[model samples]
Target: MRTNKNPSEPRFLFLITKPSLQSTLLLQALKKRFYNEVTLKHCDVIDSSTIEDGDLLLFDMMSLEEQTSRQWCQDLQNCQKKFKTLLFNIPPHYHHRDIVEWPMISGIFHTETGEENLIEGIRTVCRGEKFFPKSINDYLTQQLNLSHPQWNETVDLTHREKQILSKLRQGASNIEIAHLLFISENTVKTHIYNLFKKLSVKNRTQAVFWANKYLR
Candidate 1:
């Protein structure tokens, strides 16, 4: 499976219960779209020996049993290195907050998700950025606020702070944020520090978490 030895290349391993015409078509499309950049695989279980950092594990939720799907997600979490996981073909009526809240989940797609959106989501997740929909994010945020009432208090964020926070939520580095905003690295750091204080969070991850709950 490690036919490509280039460490810089991105690998995609699709874990489905079984193959179908839809899966075959989707794989073909991804191959054509990504060219030689992506390596595709289908397996019954994760083989740590072949896994690499930055590899994406796409779970076909529509094909797998509920308990099995959740277990596979947990198994990914226990892997030695960091890897991105995306749940696709999720049922509209499914409500598994535990899987949604898992740290390894980079995105989720429902059965109704369009092909274009799914392709874009795969690219986004592979780039180390999360790709959850607004509805899912809003639901998580609402649940967070319900659990922690202190965050319910109104906290006004400056226009600039909000912009910086949004970038942070996208997993942008300090340098990337500075470049995108056309601001100095020092200025970005200053804004980040100020926002951290305002959000009552110490670091970028916590600040992003706070924003996910408090901000839209």
Candidate 2:
């Protein structure tokens, strides 16, 4: 959840590993699109003095080596800026899974992510929301599967809940689930809330994790 002091207007600071002509053009496009709602700034490095407490930090990972990425992740963790961070251009086989565990990282962007989706992701994160692409979520599922605990088959779940979980595992949103299940959106929300309690999970992502761990 976002705790922006001024929710009406939020600032964005993008930290690129190395600036280029292409990046400059991209920033100009972004500014043109988001001129009314967002304030945008780009830097080749992290500058804590320029960052505010509630600002959103967009970290471009395209040019980072593995060791350098790890070091920067640690630095961001230790920094006192308290800014929400989003990582973009993460490699598909990225080795540093610990980056996902960083509490300050509010979202991730993959190399295959489309430009429109990237903009939407930035918008979502700026609004104090976390944005994890389906690919990233699938990667997390694979990671969880490797070290998953033994399933307690007796953990009771209703047929409907199981159905919902199945759709969730396929990355269906609540609206999509409701449409497919021939139920009201409100009912889907109700079932999701109850199912989360039954599964001892918090969000849809965790529920998907639980499903993959046990259902598969």
Candidate 3:
């Protein structure tokens, strides 16, 4: 994800909790292989001009140091207009919500992450996409295996919206959805827009993600 559409362009900022020569080495390792496509620097998130540009800010902060990180996120949220932040929080506490739950933070990684996870997370972050790893998902699934999940996605779903999304889940196109529901194609578009808005998703992929996650 450090690689941009233009190879010469860099799209990331590496924010370290405490700067050191060791971190300098890590920066060299990060950028050496990614081509001339990223700017890596050791910085304190508190007073970083590098972090203010709405670029991805990779923090190597810890959860025990929560207030500082929250202030850092609040600052980013206030100043940045358009960006996705990727946070790298170390072990013993992955619940660094102050930053990770910010709309700016599009992805998060644990200290124990592998190369594949890091790569995929960066890619997803660049696309403004959200990702929860299977290990995290598996851990959550075990704790929350209590009972049925109440599907409230359909609460705002109009009778027609539910029917429309059901058709969508069945892989129906606008023409097919129109025909199946006995509505015009134009009306179908209106309903589809409503579905997208009601579900708070801009595209079909997110709609499907929300549907499969909560509606199913």
Candidate 4:
């Protein structure tokens, strides 16, 4: 509904795995309707260093192999600079939830999602909130709730850890959280490691789910 575009808005970059009519139409629709800086690059040849902070990568999962897509997401997670990753063109019947396991994934746009819903999801993701469908959210919730409640009583998170956990819930990257908390990136990682151990969670998504259930 908000048609006005700002120059400072997060740039949308489409990472095309394979050229298709659907990909072209999606790009054209995004360019015409929502963003001023929407652009496309082949995922195979994209230079990870060129993706800057505040840029969102929309990966076309329609053509990408699952393992290959996970590798790209993992690579993005390992980058020094913070960036948002969104998977689009996901088939409606996609049963693999492992791809969403990456904390770098801020959103997903299914092939069945309408244009308006896609645009809305992108806008929600740009605003720093995860845009997962209810089904994905429920999946994560179930995965995390399997843990014992006694662990929550033994775990005591520091103030900084709590802050970082909150940031993780909002889908912030380590680099982004560091900049936000005025701490060094290494410091952020250290705290994250400590907290992850304390919480008995392995990654950001699990940490966030723990925070959701345990943190007040």
Candidate 5:
């Protein structure tokens, strides 16, 4: 499918939003700041026909109701869209750590900010850089360390593998793990296989019993 391609000029961005006054304010500020420097579009979402390469998606994600936001984040992991998605808000309570927040926002410019800061965030994200609010930096660090144990400097298992095991230990099925991890069921099986091979286990039940053994 043909996207709004213009590689020679400024990058393109699309917003698939549920719509809110705060989102509207942010979009208006972005437009005013980078009128000629960027191309913008609005869609209901990056669906089967949506998303193109070199395009960054600015999701007014928090504008959605809580249950909707959770479901949307779930879909994003499984979505076939090729562009990178940056959610506007991180969950106030986080249970995962591998996800980075700084790459999503640069300098906590509010919808109240007029043109300058809004343009900065757009250009920053468009260039594949993220800016975060100064106020949230410490929180990011605290949350990162709380998710899973880090052995030496690296995770004992790759984050994906560890994530699946975590859910498995919690008694989730492969299908449930896949949905929670935003991976396909086949991929989940592959991860399970690799985990078995890596841990020298024969099956899921064994993996669960042995998962924490590698932590220390």
Candidate 6:
């Protein structure tokens, strides 16, 4: 596993998909915000030699069938270099929740994910964290609850944290959340960090998942 302690170094992000306008625009958007922190690259083919340890691979999920996707994931796992993988453009009703168990897959990006969420997901995965869409998380939670029922543990959070979490479940951005709560964005960030810690989640998506499963 590659450790990235230095924040100044550029993280190589490889997009594994055919060239298209949408892909180009996505790369441009990433460059605009993370130009100093990320280097964008594209490859139509997946080759071991072309990948490097610590590189982040963004796979276009729409480009592969279920079996092919599994094979590709296996190939990545067998590769000599270790890299993080993120699957994007997955539909809400996607049936491959089992894909989450794959160690190489660090995150799953839904079609409805906002730009801010997308950027945050990338950063979260780069930090050796896993990301999942709320729907998938909800599904897995349901499955786990069925297989092994246990008394629910209540987590205590501040009133403000609960308010912010409610907004987050509604897909509100930090700025929108701040506006709704009549608080500064920085204050929202502080509350968000606190909530993440309390919920034992790393990103907004996972936090929303926790809120839906317990708070709802």
Best by TM-score: 4
RMSD of 5: 9.2
The prediction achieving the highest lDDT against the true structure is: 4
TM-scores, all models, native as reference: 0.59, 0.54, 0.51, 0.69, 0.50, 0.55
Candidate 4: stretches off by over 4 Å: 1-9, 145-152, 156-198, 208-216
Computed on alpha carbons, the lDDT of every model, listed in order, comes to: 0.68, 0.66, 0.57, 0.74, 0.53, 0.68
RMSD of each: 10.2, 12.4, 10.7, 4.9, 9.2, 14.8
lDDT of 4 by residue, 1-216 (tens): 222256435654555566668778878888876555677777666357777667778887777776676677666765655677788788867764665665477898888788899888888887779998888888767666737553454577789999988988877777778889999989999999998888877667777777877789
Off by over 4 Å in 3: 1-10, 40-45, 48-54, 96-99, 135-216
> Where does candidate 6 have its weakest 10-residue lDDT segment?
144-153
Error of 4 at 100 (Å): 2.8
What does candidate 6's lDDT look like per residue over 176-216, in tens digits? Answer: 67778898988998999988787766556567667877895
**On lDDT, who's better, 1 or 4?**
4
- lDDT (10s digit) by residue, model 3, range 1-216: 234554322365454556567556656665664454455443343654444333666666552256776666545533423455566655644553333344444666777876567666766665556666566456445433323243135446778887878876654556667878899978988988988777666544345556766675
- Candidate 4, poorest ten consecutive residues by summed lDDT: 1-10
Clashing residue pairs in candidate 5 are 105-131, 106-131, 106-132
lDDT, candidate 1, 89-153, per-residue tens: 88877785654644367888888898899888887776667888888788666654434644433
lDDT of 5: 0.53
User: What ranking of all candidate models by lDDT puts the best one first?
Assistant: 4, 6, 1, 2, 3, 5
Residue 120 miss distance in model 6 (angstroms) = 1.4
- Give the alpha carbon lDDT tens digit for every residue of 7-99 in model 5: 432255655565567567756765555453333444344352454455566655445555655555455444433455555544455322323
- Provide backbone clash counts, one per model: 0, 0, 0, 0, 3, 0
| Candidate achieving higher TM-score, 2 or 3 | 2
Q: How far off is model 2, as Cα RMSD?
A: 12.4
